[model samples]
Target: MDRTELFLAIIAYTLIVQTFGGKAEGAMLPLFVLLFALPIYVVVHLYRNPSLE
Candidate 1:
């Protein structure tokens, strides 16, 4: 498995989940946008690029 990606996914998932956990109480939208965008970009990249290896 991709360790770095796994680590980041877990971290991002935790952050996103936590932020939305309590009705998004005190959630930072700018930061959330950034974090939320990253995974989407990565997913798009992977799908578009295919397994180059």
Candidate 2:
């Protein structure tokens, strides 16, 4: 259970809940954006600052 695995698990759970929870029409869109953007942001940030780990 590394950081990537945990991040993916969280994204999977969020997508499952959003798909099955029966919310409004466009409610999950922001969550979808966040889920997609977050990894990219993390990757870019890590690339710029490689001293994190």
The candidate maximizing lDDT is 2
Residues 1-53 of candidate 2 have per-residue lDDT tens digits of 98678767766767787778887446556567767988899999999999987
Best by TM-score: 2
lDDT of 2: 0.74
Of candidate 1, the 10-residue stretch with the lowest lDDT total is 24-33
TM-score for all models, in order of appearance:
0.42, 0.54
lDDT of each: 0.69, 0.74
* True-structure lDDT of candidate 1: 0.69
lDDT of 1 by residue, 1-53 (tens): 58567656666766796766986544456456656987998899899998865
Q: Superposing all C-alpha atoms, what RMSD in Å does each candidate have to the true structure?
A: 6.1, 4.4
lDDT of 2 at 52: 81
List candidate 2 segments past 4 Å from native: 1-23
Root-mean-square deviation of Cα positions for candidate 2 versus the true structure, in angstroms? 4.4
